[model samples]
Target chain A: MKEENVIEAEELTKAFGDFKAVNAISFEVKKGEIFGFLGANGAGKTTAIKMLIGISKPSSGQATVAGFDVYTQRESIKKNIGYMSQKFALYDDLTVKENITFFGGIYGLSRAKIKEKREQLISELGLEDISNKLVGSLPLGWKQKLSFSVSLLHDPKIVFLDEPTGGVDPITRRQFWEMIYKAADRGTTIFVTTHYMDEAEYCDRVSIMVEGKIEALDTPKKLKEQFKVDSMNDVFLKLARE
Target chain B: MSITLNHISKSYKKLKAVQDISFNVEPGELFGLIGPDGAGKTTIFRIITTLLIPDAGTASVAGFDVIKDYQAIRNTVGYMPGRFSLYQDLTVEENLTFFATIFGTTIAENYDLIEDIYVQIEPFKDRRAGKLSGGMKQKLALCCALIHKPKVLFLDEPTSGVDPVSRKEFWEMLKRLQQKGITILVSTPYMDEAALCDRIALIQDGKILEIDAPEAIVNKFPKKIYNVGADNMYKLIRTLQGYEHLYSVFPFGEFVHYTDKRDSFEAADLKSYLKNAGLTDISIEATQPNIEDAFMELAK
Candidate 1:
């Protein structure tokens, strides 16, 4: 059986005047796979992600995400994907349940469905007692979990998470990965970006972006073996220094 | 001791920000306070630098009492906070000169101290600090912090949002600074960075869990850990979590970190069990514990 490619990009190029933020990159993401996009601070990882998510048009390239054309069918692409950016995009002043309800409404979920999901999310995170508490009062870990759950409210075909576990504790980070695993098990594709090399190991496969080009892409083990590095951090250092 | 703390505790209203934590740093040593956000690492830094008054206990930097000799301590220590605090609208050169002037020193007077880092950002001297990239901003802030050449330096979460290459460069700069005989106390949420420190104190919830060299800390994890993987990682984690003898099962990078409560355990037994459970491509191997594994054990 052949695996489906949920995302496909060929010769993807995004240029800002003479500077190429993303230069002729090409890759495919298998359906239900967790694909890691790794890079340094200004390495154009964000630019590539924006193009795939249909927010930013590529200067020259051809791509399809969830079977929708990136150049023309962006509105359809937007409907089939969920995104959790680095900044927690939740309303801090709103109560937990209210925030969930508001986001669910934006996704056009039914009123009854939103109510059910709100309860399920609150209980799943062990927040049953404080469902009415303002999101600002919750701990950082709890807020992060809530933000992730809300991103999944509409159950889009794919989820794009940008540094979802930054500044979180080990325990919380561990638990967050567990959630990601469960979601993947249920057949949702995950596309994530992170600075933590350790987290890179969790992905099914990872691609290293250096200075707007794909430097390496393979299973973590293969990349480590090919680079002859013990860890992903060392592999990253070796490539990024070039 | 370059830095000392005795039963330091701080509370904001009812929440205990720091709880009776104590540690010491030797002169010219590179020490790390490793933990996540809200772990009370910053509170300790602020307390030692004489920026905040602890509700109880005493601290000193460079032999000066934190409470009584705050002015002297301030003159002898440099602090780079987690967030960038430079004048964003000003040019890089202007910001550097302003910070140097306030510290009663000129950039030319301390040229040697910041020469390595300043040279990297010198081309952008005329660019506004706000317009600089993340790595460039970090370098500028570091240079300004060292302009006066303080004996001890405190950096809070310096590499949190930085990229791999820049992070490597920053650590290299820290090594050069340490070689110059300046005591450094750095706090980071990254466990791998702990190995670069001479010694580290693992902090959580405003308390020190353990303090030792990075290798020593990893050696302290008593349980045997195995790196386990299968064709279906999601199913692998779920199945392993249900295993009766498991002590902990969490997803690591490529493998699931598995530990059993019972000391009497064998890989063959678990391997056959997974095979029977309809899992293929199983790879299980005993692995040495790392600082993060040790931290999870200590934090428990």
Candidate 2:
């Protein structure tokens, strides 16, 4: 009973002139799984992510994201996936309701459904009182949660989060993971990149990249066992040092 | 003491960025200010570096008053801000040289102070600072901060976005710098990094929640914690949230951290409860508290 892979990459490579930013990396992400992509700064994590998300073309090899070809069929792939970057992409000047409506509009949701979802999202995040307030006036934690909620407005098959919890506090990070768990429970595949090693342990499986290549990939437990370390941070340190 | 603060406070209109807070950093010790964004870590750093004036109280660096001896404090301390501040268009070597020249020193004179770090970036000397990788930029910023050979250093979230490996290397560099008797004050939101500091002040909402050695802080967590996991994690959390004896249930990595309101609660009781609730693959084990656990307890 093998589950279908939501993402499949075979020797995916991306080169910038003489520099091969993502070189010959291959991995598979199962449907409804939280896959953590980790690497040191400049280790090609972003380059690889860009290729999969259809923003950048691979120089060689092949990849299929949400069952759509990376080289072609990019538009279909884009529609089936959601993305949230380190920077919260909500319009600051717009109110919370306005930001939700704007993103829902871009995703082409029906006006009626968008109205329903906007109410649901605002209530779920306990932003009811601040629904009419400008987004810039909200706190960092609230803004991040709002950004995450907006990314899923279209109910995409997969979500890509790049360092989504970089500067947040531990308490907020805990709450954010709860959101991730809820999304995963709903059968949406999560493809995320983060610097927090502890967050790696939260993933169903993690792949470590270094020097434009996949250095290691496995469940956090197995990776820790293979590296003979007690924590994922130690496992990463050992691999990155190599 | 290399750094000292006596009831320092700073405010922006109605928002108190830093409320009456006081602490001391020993000479040559690595101290961490652990907090979240808008927690006033940067405000405190700015005041100590003499960049922003504190609204009340006083601070000193290297025995010089932050207000009276701003010039001496600036000369004797190194500060690396959260944002990358080097000339983006300048090459790595050019940026380092410019910083050295401004400090009335040459690379040749301060070569030993930055040798270990500089060597790592030397190969990329011709690359523009902005073009360098995050790790390389961090190293370059550190090198520039050290070019003057200051006795004290203040780093505000230096490894905020850096990878774990580069973070380890940066901390190793800090250790080497400490060996040279330079006091360091660093702020980060990462809880794991708190363990690397000799002592840390857990701050939030412009107040110090706790301050002590990392181990001591973890040791101070009030209750026994159990790691609980089952097939349905979200359900497990919801069920535990409704449990009568549960104090708190928060997700930690792969497991939900559970603490009981009753001190005498046992793991078997939790295991049986989960099993009765139709949770398969249920596992419950007692676990020691970490910095985050301590922080959560203190924050409550």
Candidate 3:
């Protein structure tokens, strides 16, 4: 069964005053595929995600996520998609359980569902011992994983993660990707951004952004072959140089 | 100039940030301090640069005592802090000029040292340092540090939060600076970056784990390594972990990196083990260990 794409964008553009953060980028992510959005810092990856998730409006072009128009159906799109920002974004002063409950409530999950999801997320992330601990006290890896779990508490149709593994240990990053794979296996489209070239190889497909545009987009294997490079790192170096 | 740290330990209240760390950095060597966050890399850098004095132990840079000859040490070493501690309100050019003035030198005096990096960001020279991009901020901070032509350069995670391209560029710049025979001491959390150094000291939990060349560190892994892959990889890892001879099993991208408990166990045995476990399309191959692998083994 060839399911329809979970995300589609055409000539998407976003301008902040005179700067075009995301310029004329177009890509599609099929349902259940892990799509990697890659770029250098300040290379428009975050801006594109912001538009696709309906948090930032695109100045031009058309986009649809989870079958909802990004411009007209912002509410519907928000309800069906999850986003984890570059910054941890969770309230540091809140307890682990409180953060979970707060995010669940914001997503409009009922009180019963919030309680159920909170318990499940805590147990899955092995945060039970620290559930009562303040979020500030948790390690960076733990905070990242917990933030990811909370993002998926409502079982959105798709999830967007912006550099989710930045500054995390390789082992922790490995574990986090495992969670992403599990989610994708359950038919959730995964959209993620990362600076680690090796991590790009994990995606089913990846789009490399330079300046404000998508310079290259393909499966990691195809990109490596196209660039005639042995590793993703070499492929990135080749493309970034151009 | 060479650096020596003898029984260097620093503490704050009840917490020990660094504990009795002793090491020597030879002249013209690119020494890297590799570790996770809060691993005392920053504290050690501060102590060595004379910004913070250790409660005990002694440190000397270029034969000058770090505490007693603080001014001399500061003048002889260039430091790029972990947090990009520079004057954000000033423009890139202004920051460079101000730092050079503090050291009683002009940017023109050492223009050749940072010319390559400066030229790339010269167009944005008028932009405020705070408004510059992550990579640009890194370059500006570096130029400011090197303007004084210090004998030793210290970079504390200079590539953090930067794009991969910028990271490559920054390292290239460091290599050039090293070519001028400047002793370099850099700290990074990235194991991959550790490979670029002439020698590296792996730190964890505020303690030294291992200190050696990256290649030597990788060669020290005691177990036979293998990279295994197949469809249903998660199930494969679980099954491999159950095998009697498995030393460690961890996911490495699309494949699982594993080591055998017994030297007698061969690659064929691993393949057959997966085959017998009802796994299909399995491929197993012996693999070379990397710096991260060595660090993981040592961390355990």
Candidate 4:
């Protein structure tokens, strides 16, 4: 049985002047699948993510996110996907409850639904005591978790996380992964980029981009065996070293 | 120049950024302060660089007190903060020149010190610092920091989000600089990079957990860790966490690093526990703990 793909790309390319930041990359993310996008520091991950998220226009090629065309239906695509990044996720000045309600409103949720979600999120994340506190007052770990929960307030078909757990404590990082796992279990497609190679192992399949090209794409186990490496870190080291 | 911290402590209001943190770095040695963000790595860096004075205790960089001899210490050390502190509007060459000029030196005088790193970004010298890419900006930052060519270097999170390739190359450059008799104190959130340091201080929650060589740190891990794998990664973790004798269950690459609460733990017994949970394709093997495993255990 072929799994339904929520994300499809055919030679998606993005260029700047003479540099092809994302060069003709093509891949598909199956529904509910956790896809790991790996690359070097200067590799075209940010560019590729922009193209996939319907923000920046691709220089060439074709792609669709959640059944919406990248070229003509970017607005539709935006409405069907959730985005969260470590750099920017939630408003610092807003209280936790306010942030949730605000994001729910932005996602076009009704008042009743937003109220229900706000309560559920607060209790689920064990933030009852701090729900009324400003998001900026919370610890980095808590803010990160709150933002992740808020990103799903509208229940987008897919969630694109850009290094969501970077610099978080190890325990909290694991907790965040548990959240990702639960989300994937509920059939939410997760497309994530991370520098932590170990997190790359948790994905259903990972694609490593080098110099704006997808060099490898496979399950973590297969990639390890194919490269004769014990861990994803070594596989990355071998590929990225060159 | 050596670095010594004698019970150095600092706090920002209620947060104890660094509490009684003490460590020593030999001359020309590469030392790493490994921890997560908000773990007081930056505070410690700031204290050593003479940018922030300690609330209590004392710190000496290159035989000069951080407070009493701030100017002498500043002149004796090169510091690259975690954030991009260079003038964004200035061209790369102009930024480099500006840094050199402020230190009462010319780029030509210390061109040899930053030659290897500066050469990489030299092609983009004419471009504005803000317009450069992430990797290029890092190179330019290093160039500006090294223009003064001090005895000691303080680098904060030099390779936190940097990829494996650039991180490797950056460490290589650091190793070369260390060879030239410059003590280097660098911090990173990446645990793997800890292995590259001569010695490392594992820190968290404003305190030092352990301080030793990377290999030695791993050797001192009190518990034996197992690389446990199964068909479903999430279920495996959930089941393992539910085990009665669970000490720690961290999600490592492709496998979970499982430790038992009891010293007399058996793999067969755990395998049967997982099997009862309907977990198939179970593979359990004893593995040598790395710096990360050591860190998670230490911080836990």
- Each model's fraction of native contacts: 0.78, 0.84, 0.44, 0.77
Could you give candidate 4's per-residue lDDT for residues B1-300 as a string of tens digits? Answer: 399999988989988889998889999899999988999999998888888889999989899988899999888889999998999999999999998999999999988899999889989889999999888888899888889989999999988788877888899999999998888999998888899999999999889999999999999999998999999988998898899999989888788999888979899999999999999999999989998888777776
Candidate 3 regions with alpha-carbon error over 4 angstroms = A16-19, B276-279
Please provide TM-scores, in order, for all candidate models, with all chains considered together. 0.96, 0.97, 0.94, 0.96
Clashing pairs in 2: none
Per-residue CA lDDT of model 1 for A1-242, tens digit only, reads 98999999999999999999999999999988999999988999999999999999999989999999999999988889988975856898999999999999999999999999999888898998999999987777788888988889999889999998887889899898889888888889999998888889888899999899999999888999999988888899899987
Model 2 CAPRI rating: medium
Q: What residue runs in model 1 are displaced by over 4 Å at the alpha carbon?
A: none
Ranking by lDDT: 2, 1, 4, 3
List the lowest-lDDT window of 10 residues for candidate 3 chain B: B229-238
CAPRI-style docking class of model 1 based on DockQ: medium
Where does candidate 4 stray beyond 4 Å? none
What DockQ values do the models have? Answer: 0.75, 0.76, 0.53, 0.72
Error of 1 at B8 (Å): 1.9
Distance from true position, residue B58, model 1, in Å? 1.7
Mark the regions of model 2 whose C-alpha exceeds 4 Å error after superposition.
none
Clashing pairs in 1: A201-B253, A202-B253
Which predicted model would earn the best DockQ? 2
